[model samples]
Target: MIITAVLPALSKEASIGNIVLSEIAEYKDDKQISHPYNEVKGAVLNLHQFNGHNIGVIIPAYNEENLIGETINGIPEYVKRIYVIDDCSTDSTPEIVKRLTDPRIVSVRHEKNQGVGAAIISGYKLALEDNIDIAVVMAGDNQMDPKQLPKLLEPIVEGRADFTKGNRIIRGYWKGMSKWRLSGNFLLTWLNKIASGYWNISDPQNGYVAISVSSLRKFNLDSLYGGFAFENDMMIKSNILGIRMMNVPIPARYGKEKSKIRYNRFIIHTSWFLLISFLYRISNKYLFRFHPIGIFYFTGFILIIFGIVLLLFWPVLILGLVSFTFGIALEMKEINKSQLRGL
Candidate 1:
């Protein structure tokens, strides 16, 4: 496969080297399997010097001066290019990138500081322009494991899915993540399931991801949310576009990397974002795509709204709550039925 890894790096000076080198080791382990494929009793299914595939790494940096150089140096020699996007950093991020002498490194700068979503978009556009077949995303903080790239790419390369993402909450892995972050991610995942209709996906906030070029082009890049909600926003878009998606069980990795997110602000903004996006999806799917079942979501929403508004009137409140609950149950049943039929 023509593979490209996109790293949305920030101020990762302390940990970037270890993460990058880990990717090299992962690539070496992959190269040892001569056939690279096997037949299972029930089923089936990157970057070092052993393989013939062209590889690229895109690192979008913002004020990542201390770690950007180490990050770039750690890419395996087999990688064909590394695209570094500087998003108007007030620090020396650009100069650090410019000082790198590796022929594989290519730098792009944003005139202003956009969010991580925008930085990834910039990297994605470059990967597309470079004609890469598969584009993978890795956060600059080094929280994502480099060894798991193979797992993320298997479904896409095998034509089983168009998009694949990491699921940090799977198989009891949440025990390692911070309690506050874990709770927030779970809540966001629940909300995302309702809005995006991807009941199967978890860890909605995990940024480790991969997408086929064909599937990536199907989205309107300009319209994607440019904040922390960007990953969730992409899930909603995937639902709207009918992209086949799956999640890989990956463990959470947290260290000295300081988070730039403010939970209070994030909660308010992301709530509004999802609410508006959900409404837009309802309108688009029902009115435009012609999915008749959209009425279920609307009915449930309206009843819930009425129930909250009539809280002072005990009789109306009780009646409204019952009806709202029933509406949600019916909707959920329908969704389950659709899944059973393989819709």
Candidate 2:
């Protein structure tokens, strides 16, 4: 509402485009390609006005020497610094970072190719040392637009949310995304939300995010998995701690950079990760950490026992089949569907 007038200069295309008959509430249709340019402007303004906090950008690159420069140059001047960590890439990424002329840019090199998760953790540590109040993760592949950066960070900056993430599947980018990937993200996202207990979230696999200094300080960084399942694992742990997670929408840009992940394998690996992370979060939050329920393992043990009993002989036995049906129905109500079968 107010953002449209305040951000006239920010995006003539988005503003004028929204006024077009086709562009109004383009987000409502699942096939409209547009970014909420005015929304991004409002978010950037909110970030500046909230608490006077400083900002930092963390870009984790594997072999993205081609597009990283433009991605870096596109960030607004208000952002304090950019940390470009070369995750032991085989390409010329390291050399490109060294040649960059921006004074605010800092580069880190890893001896071996650590996965994206490890690189992000290292960047978080670096930002903590630099005294940055908030840290935002950007991909080495320039798929995410920097104009939407502020929206991802505003919640944490305003002290209204502990952690914030981008939800491309729900955002204006939905139209730009493929049906298969969209389906995969939805299934995994729905599973993660129930398993982790953050019911209000969407787009569980998106990597773009902003985290507060306090949340980062309180997190057990050593416990997070450093590979592809890192973001899901982080949210699982955060949910256990009762940290608020808010998902902001961003424009999806799909281009020449090949997705390192295979879709089928993504589902299997992330499903296992969600189960493991769920148990860990429950154990750590309830048993080892605190007994909010006044019993160390009441809820966890009950759920596990019920699951085991139903799985024991449900296939062949009639009584066991009945128990299994009732048990699954109860759990379906509690956790909802296992995975969203369709996008």
Candidate 3:
């Protein structure tokens, strides 16, 4: 039952405090509280001591000198160790981490600047080397609330799931989230649901997550996407491995941390990434593999395209339309049948 938390930060000195021991809204009634820490601490204390569960925390920092200490200090005492990965920050992020008095803190520095995903992958490698049982991902900018972590960890600990993530869309909590982000989240989530074959999860963009070490080892870390699309890339890989993923309801917290994302670029870049990943997923899941549904899905897509191109030929257009409709019907039927089978 050993658990480790991983935090990825990038130039977030202003916003990291918003996440540490942050106020969490009660799922039942939306009542804000500051003591998810107490509840989680108590739960850990009550676990069977003989089970030997140890919790380790990891932080990936890149030029986050202003708020790294606050982020590290805010972690609950129940954790066994904190790994801070300094991804070649131009600032004094590594120096700041070294000055921390907590003996559990371990700093790993990268010689060059890699993206956040690479930093996280590096930390994952370290966690695996040390044989950490379960690794949790938290952000260095403090967007992830530690109080709700138990919800994410419970399924993995109980052997019900290999990976778990936070879902901020439940209960219509999107009111506080930025409208642009809300739209992007919805689009990406829908695409991810189809691509990953994990229909139960929403808010696929949510970074707060916990994954079993065994599952992490199954991935080729070097091949994963390195930018903001990294999380979405992980989901696709997880689906390929047939690992179970569960989503826990968690509220979104926005604060002083200025987002590095540019809306136009994010949408354009991520949309392309998702579209390509979706095609790759379909190919791997159906065409490359022996799955009946994949045949119908792709046939339907191809027919639709052909139908548009052959509009001048009335007979061919009619035939393509009919074929496309039938293909879509079969694909839908198989999707429903698969869901029932899972149940």
Give stretches of model 1 more than 4 Å off: 1-56, 76-79, 287-290, 312-343
Which regions of candidate 3 deviate over 4 angstroms?
1-52, 310-343
- Mark the regions of model 2 whose C-alpha exceeds 4 Å error after superposition: 1-51, 287-343
Any idea what lDDT model 2 has?
Answer: 0.66
Residues 107-187 of candidate 2 have per-residue lDDT tens digits of 666777768898888778767766478888988888878888778777666666778888887636788888898888888
- lDDT (tens digit, per residue) of candidate 1 on 2-109: 212222211121122222211111111111211111110111002342134344455666777666776666655655556676777888877666665554454667
TM-score of 2: 0.72
Q: What is the C-alpha RMSD of each candidate to the true structure, in Å?
A: 10.4, 14.5, 10.8
Per-model TM-score, in order, reads 0.75, 0.72, 0.76
- Relative to the true structure, candidate 3 reaches a TM of 0.76
Better of 1 and 2 by TM-score: 1
The 10-residue segment with the lowest total lDDT in model 3: 41-50
Model 1 sits at a Cα RMSD from the real structure of 10.4
TM-score, predicted candidate 1 vs. hidden true structure: 0.75
